[model samples]
Target chain A: MSFRLALQESPGNPWFSWRYVQDNSDTILAALREHAILTAEAMLIATAVAVPLAVVAYWYRPLTGPILALSGVLYTIPSLALLAFVAPYVGTTNPGSVLIALVLYALLLIVRNSLAGLNQVPPEARDAAQGMGYGRWGRLFRIDLPLALPGIVTGLRLATVSTVALVTVGALIGHGGLGDLILTGFRNNFYKAEILTGAVLCVVLALVLDLLLAMAGRLLTPWSRRAVR
Target chain B: MRSENPIQQALTWLNDPLNWTNPGGILDRLGEHLWISAAAVALGCVVAWPIGMWLGHAGRGGSLVVLISNLTLAIPTIALLTILPLTFLGFGKPPVVVALAVFAVPPLLANAYTGVRSIDPEARDAARGMGLSGWQVLGRVELPLAVPYLAAGFRTASVQVVATAALASFVNGGGLGQIISAGFGLGISVGGGQILAGGFLVALLAMLVEAVLAVVERVVTPKPLRKARGRAARRAAVATGSA
Candidate 1:
């Protein structure tokens, strides 16, 4: 029983029932926008760095082992530990901290898939392209790339889902979006509908994102459609 | 119990069961976390197993499903945990469980699906030729064959759930996370030690599960693979001797 609630719900009640939900909707919405943008930016950054590295690593198998091993070690580190480790360089409250972690997590997937996809290309196909007087770049684009598209797309799809989910961790830093609502519910002492609402929305976001990625994978790999039949 | 002894004082405070009282106390909280994780993983396996089986039979869809599941692997549980309380309105095990299930689903589904899809075409065709119905064939042939893969999936999901369940503390759902979080309170050594212990305990529980499953996997591996493995070992020994 607080003052705010007594004024609104029951005059005798003293509880100040602040409508956190009402007050925070706009903030959450704004955070979602930032989250989406952050995810996209991180993916772009990670791809730009990882894909070329993967290609070069593919050409030299020795580098692939070390890069992959590094990614595996990165994977073992808990997300919070990684964030706290890097908090000094980039303020934790900012979107950049979470975004950077997301990119790091994604690098392994992108690099592994890229290298695997490239290696999966039939050697004869590349030979044929080379025989056609295609240089290294031409062979890569014309012959090797199309074959590897499926794996690359697979990696990107993985990276996207991961980034979207990870962006919520940024909420601890006072970044908005659903995480803000959930964290508030937590700090406010107990379960209220507001917290559950945010969580459900996040799960829905994940499920919807998963389906969209699946559709995208299908579209990207037309060959798969035939292979299924 | 009040003493000038620093080490004894810390030990008594830590060992005191009375410290963990209240509604969301330490011991009760750890129990809640395990319960939630166990429930969610059990439920996830039920859903994932069938989907995995169906996907395995459906060829072409294998990579696509794998791709989708892999993507889900990317979404951090912490983010999901954070968003859950807000969207679901007041955090509890339900949202946490859902988040965990999403995390656990990919490995189970992917492994189960791959197991079925990767079954020898000859074996499937032979089963079909014997007039065995699709369901029967799947039950008798496909499933037993896929056990090793399913076990692998289960192993991955189990460890994942245990580790991620720590996030449940963020939303006040209580678990080992509360102990860990409480350790962050004051005296860094006191708090940090608790957190370390809780993390170690969770890791140990997860490893125990993995080891038990590894035994099951070893048992499930076909006799031929075991025989071949022995032969390979013998050949290696002989080659080394000759060299």
Candidate 2:
């Protein structure tokens, strides 16, 4: 009993426990801030660019192939390689460069989902809207967008999670959020506390973001949640 | 601001014969990168494939599998790689392999499960009606139908492994990242060029892997399934599966 108690009480053995976590609150919070800022900026930018382009593709039809192809090619680039590739041009410290690269990743995901969301809007709903005197633009804004919300949220959720992972790769850019601690630990001053804290905090941040988004999606799109539920 | 001529330097870097033949040269590094990445993918398959297959065959836990895969996907690979060395792993290729394999599992499991679950219920019913036992139905029908999805998953895992394997250099695990990090270690100038050169190599390899896997996916999908499965369709299959 004493041996088990001593082992459990050891700070190293209980790294993730409430006791140990409090000791590293500062380190954890810094990483959480970096992770959140980069993720939000990237998602916001990707959504802004992707929705318009998706609308254009939906409207034009011809550009669909090209847009898809371009995004597909970009997606094939390794996340780390993209960071390393861009680090030289952007300088390591600027978060904008990381944001730009991360935004490129969300492009394909958001665009496809946007288009799918719009497309998946039942023809009946649009027809019913038109019959009720909703004009083209009004139909899109009032009917299509709302109906498409579920899928777009789904896409956004995915983009957010993916970007979370990529932010660590951003460490190479020297703007990396939780990644800097891990990389610093790996390279110069090897410390289990920093590495463990960073890893745990990064994962926790992702989980929190994921839960928040999922809850937000459910709350905002009650209609879709009904269907899904 | 685009100041450096990384493309030109990358070209020169590639053209130089010395880079290929020297000890720890590009060729050796390339080989090391491939096998190690491949090994990680293999390890991922070993872990994920059975669970995926069992869940997929039972037509159960699709949502659970997907949920777990999503959670797994959210973990930063660099964080995994870094923290692993602190967990009795120490800095080396083994840690790299473990980290890469951890990241690789989600895609593998998600696609495999999705592939099986996506099959027409009628087909499963027909196979059962035809006097096939559970094992027989799975072996003869569902697993075959899942080949394309499995292939797609493997491809995603392999490419991601190859691309990120460059990070192994951070832990003194040798790969092309060694050269790229050396460039960054210098802070600018020649480093910029090497980073680009290194990135281009990694990107090109990822594309090549993706292209090859695409062809394999096309070939493996049964002809009728292939009829509806274009590049976009295949991509949607893998994306929504993992998503």
Please report the candidate that would top DockQ against the real structure: 2
Worst 10 residues of 1 chain A by lDDT: A1-10
Give the runs in model 1 whose Cα sits over 4 Å from its true position.
A1-25, A84-96, A132-147, A189-229, B1-39, B54-99, B125-136, B179-219, B223-243
Per-candidate clash tally: 34, 1
The C-alpha RMSD in Å for every predicted model, in order, reads: 9.5, 4.4
Give the whole-model CA lDDT for all candidates, comma-separated: 0.64, 0.76
Candidate 2's residue-wise lDDT over A1-68, tens digit each?
01223323345543345654578677667867887899999999999998888777776899988987
- Docking quality (DockQ) of candidate 1: 0.10
Which pairs, if any, clash in model 2? A171-A176
lDDT (Cα, 0-100) at B14 in candidate 1: 55
> What tens-digit string does per-residue lDDT give for candidate 1 at A1-229?
1122222323332122346546766865775677667777888999998888878887777887798778655544444444433443465356676777777867876777777778889888888888899998888777777788876876776666666666666665565356666666656653344556565566566567657877887887787678646
